[model samples]
Target chain A: MHEDRQQFIQGVRDCLPTLLGYIGIGAAFGIVGASSNVSLLEIALLSLLVYAGSAQFIICALFVVHTPIPVIVATTFIVNLRHFLMGLAIAPAFSQYSMKQNVLLGTLLTDETFGVAASKLTKQTKLNASWMHGLNITAYLCWLLSSLAGAMLGQWIEEPTVFGLDFALPAMFVALLIIQLQQQAAGKLMHLLAVVGYTIIFMVVFSFVVPSHLAVLLSTMSAATIGVLTKR
Target chain B: MTISTTMLLIIIGCCLVTLIPRIAPFILLKKVSLPKWMTDWLSYIPICILTALIVQGMWTAEQGKLIISWHYMLALIPTVIAALWTRSLAVTVIVGVVAMALVRMFS
Candidate 1:
């Protein structure tokens, strides 16, 4: 127990840099959501619950479109389906953990957490549960605080888009994708196929769709399908 | 438009749908072994979904009009270059914003 606590502290220290990035990005998201006329409560809810950056951005866009409830729900489900895969990919690493521990850790699983944890697992035999938990918790806390700050200050900023804030979400993803491709084995090919498939589906469907939500839903489903079919 | 009860309900519904998938894995994956094929496919979803989103964001205008404007083209130049060279999230986003702003200004 003592050793676990120490390792967890170390994990938090190591993950600090990554956590800072999530804060900045998450705050930007909060600002965007606020600027889109979403209420402070909604922004907070999204920050705490949705947690997925890109999906939150899309949700805000749907809000702007005043999309129907059913469509919005469907779109959110599709966009976040990747989280399921992320959870599964990390399952083997946590096989020894109790179901409660898995559930707790799973709640904190994000792209950043998974990347760091998976890399760590590859290098070491025995997992440091505390450190893993600490890393994820630190990131999650940063995200929540940053989002709250953004929501509070969002109304004061008249033009987030004019400040070029709208570009951050996509830019962040592109950057992350590029880095992931360079570092992970087979990352480039997998990411390239995913991107190409998504783009084709979005372009084909978006033009004819009335509610923009459909474009996101269909594209995400198509991507998931492609991902499932081509898995190693 | 007034904040109608209907709209509020819609928002609540949307929230539930979004939260379920994220929450489900924590519950379901705890006891089950996901098939190998499923695992393989899930790996690719992020890249594909992100690509579709970014391309659409860069190209589409209001009402789905495709605009191959010089501003967008110019913005892409810096974005692509920054993404490939730096591969840093902050750098890429900063460059993209700067590129778009410059394109919007000069054009």
Candidate 2:
């Protein structure tokens, strides 16, 4: 129980950077939702249940245009389809964890949390359910509360990115990624470079041909396949 | 802000769509054992996905074309240094925020 407490604390600590980013973006989402004429209660519910930032943001835009409900639902599914891959990627690590634990973990898994946990896993750090909950619930709370506050703040700021908060997502990803590569790439630097280089090139080319989200999924899956094939 | 029936439906619908994709794999894989190659492939996914995100996040899409945001690219210099030097997620994030703020303020 004591170690569980420690793991929980560590998870919360690991999520601190994610917390800062969430506060700004969550509130910005709230402001956007409010300004878009969605009610505070609606925004709150969306944040609580839907919980995907991009999906919720798109929902607000669609609400204004009165896009057909079926269309919105389909778009939401497509926009978040990448999560299936994310869940598959992280599942093996949680194999020892119970179904209940995996359910909760899967529910709260976001790009940031996945990257942070994956980065830690690369360091051979041990993670328990409590840690996962601490990391997830803390981020979830920040998102919920901040968005509610932003909804109440009532849309005075036109663009929250003026404070450069939008950079957090990419920054967090890059930091996790750099650490992962540095830890694992020591022996085969060229192999690592090839994988990363392939990803960038594929993403750029795919973006030109497909939607950006689809581009990300295609590039990631294919590049990882390449990493597997070229493994020595 | 009164909640409308339509809005309620939208929220509910969005919730289902969002949750299904996120939770599907966990449910499907619960009783199955993964193959060795699958595990190896999954191991590479973290880096691949992260790289894909960073590449796309640095660019803005317009009129079916991608335009680079020099501000973000400029700010990445310090952030990457922070990551390599300290390898602390929190420190790198703080440095990134400050670096981006400076980039935005100056130009």
Candidate 3:
């Protein structure tokens, strides 16, 4: 029991870096949501429930364009379907725990938390429900608070783009890719690079042919499938 | 037609779609067994997804042509260096955002 507490705390501490990224993105989200007239209560609900940054941002953008509700909902589903892979990635760690507990922990598994948790798993070679609880919950709270703060303070934060705040997500992805790579077995980096190469090609070809998000999903699925197949 | 009702409807749709993807995998995994080959595939998903997202942002498609935005690429240089050197996401993001801001300010 004491060990679980310690793990949870460590999970929280590891999330410190994500705090900065989440605040920048989340606050920007709030500013955008407010300007678009999305109610503060609605924003809170989205953060509390939807909890996916990219999807939330897209929701705000789609709202501005007066996108149809069905389209927006469908886009949100496709954009966030990757969350399934992320959930599956970490599922093994909590296999012994009850399904309810697993769902509870998985609810908070954002991109940032998944990256942090996956890295920790690679290094520690052992994982606990406690550590995951700490990481997921801490990051979740930061996202909610930061975006809400941004919404409430939107007047002052008028132009997050002027400061290149939008680049934060891509930058975080770049850093995460590099960090995830650092954990790959040395000689096997070729397979990882193959996946990347395939993704770039697929994304380039598909982006022109299909909606970009679908292209992205296709690229990920195809590249990852090829990656696993080619690995001996 | 009011914003509140429309927004409420949208939010309800979002919550269902969003929650299903995130939560269903865990619940389904417990109930059904996946093949060993499929499990091997999960670990590779992260790199592919992250790559697809980043690379997709680096270029734009124009009228019958493709163009790479050098400014974003230029900004990524420092971000990449910071990521590789410091290996800290906070540092990399700060560098990245500042670099892009500077790039925008200048050119």
Candidate 4:
């Protein structure tokens, strides 16, 4: 097999766990979308185009409350601002690809993809464009299709939590964090601990005062700064 | 459910909001040179962001109060162990799902 083919296959293989988690969240999003007085087509389009799980959920909640259009748009933008950081984090690796390829990869860079790619790229020195495409495309399809299933069967699976599917996303994230933590340099552990500690405290104290999206952004920035300053 | 004009605009606005963040960095920063300090700081982005996301996932705010769910914390035990022991994302997720399901089933 060609090296690129092998890398692509490996990328798909690595995404299997994330796919399992996405299946549940995507369906939940679909169910919520269906119940929010939006057409199935609109729900599907949102998943296909917007493609951010938390942001989509927030949009649905605001939509149900009949939030003003500007508020909804602004909230979604703030919720998704983390993607800007994700994009910058991966920019160096993607510098090797063409503008068109970068566009495609950027569109597909969800939290799961960013998590998987960040760890994978850190371990390997070379940039595998096809491998990344494989990973992103697989995750993208899982999210889109599972969401479609949820929308189609929204009524039937009214309570997705009954089956413990709500835990899928958290579990997936925990797993990703563990992997990333294990890959960190020995001296970096202190920074990791500080970042985790600071973020928890920030979230607990400010979750009510600030919008959740802004809280997230603030916590992330602070944690990254803590890491940078503490790094030797 | 039927779509209204407002919903359509919100969707389009959402598309733009998400698209710009994802696409802009790749386009603008692709050829731009970043300082070593900036790159070192960027290295922390994933760990910091993921940590914050995990914390956010743990407890949700209800009526302006933080409600911590013991269930999520319990499930993380097995999930973290599986992640460390197996080092396999699939196995870790499966263990986590099964652990949570069992907890929900019995508790």
User: Highest DockQ: which candidate?
Assistant: 2
- TM-scores of all models? 0.71, 0.91, 0.93, 0.92
Tens digits of lDDT, candidate 1, A48-133 = 76677767777788878878767766777766665665565566567677877777787777766765665454445346668889
Q: Which clashing pairs does model 3 show?
A: none
- Tens-digit lDDT track of model 4 for A1-232: 4987998888888777689889988987888877776678888888888889988888988999989999999989999999999899987787887889888888888888899988876687556778888898899999999998989888676666667777777777788888888887788666687778887787777687777677777888887787788766
Q: Rank candidates, DockQ, best first.
A: 2, 4, 3, 1
The candidates' DockQ values read: 0.40, 0.67, 0.63, 0.65
**Interface quality of candidate 1 as DockQ:** 0.40
- iRMSD, per candidate, in listed order: 4.5, 1.7, 2.2, 1.9
Segments of candidate 4 deviating more than 4 angstroms: A1-4, B62-64
Distance (Å) between predicted and true CA of B71, model 3? 3.4
Superposition TM-score, candidate 3 onto the true structure: 0.93
Candidates in descending lDDT order:
3, 2, 4, 1
Off by more than 4 A, model 2: B61-64
> Deviation in angstroms for A68 in model 3?
2.2
Tens digit per residue, CA lDDT, model 3, A71-173: 9999999888878888887777677778888898777778888877777666664478888888888888999999999998886767777787778888888
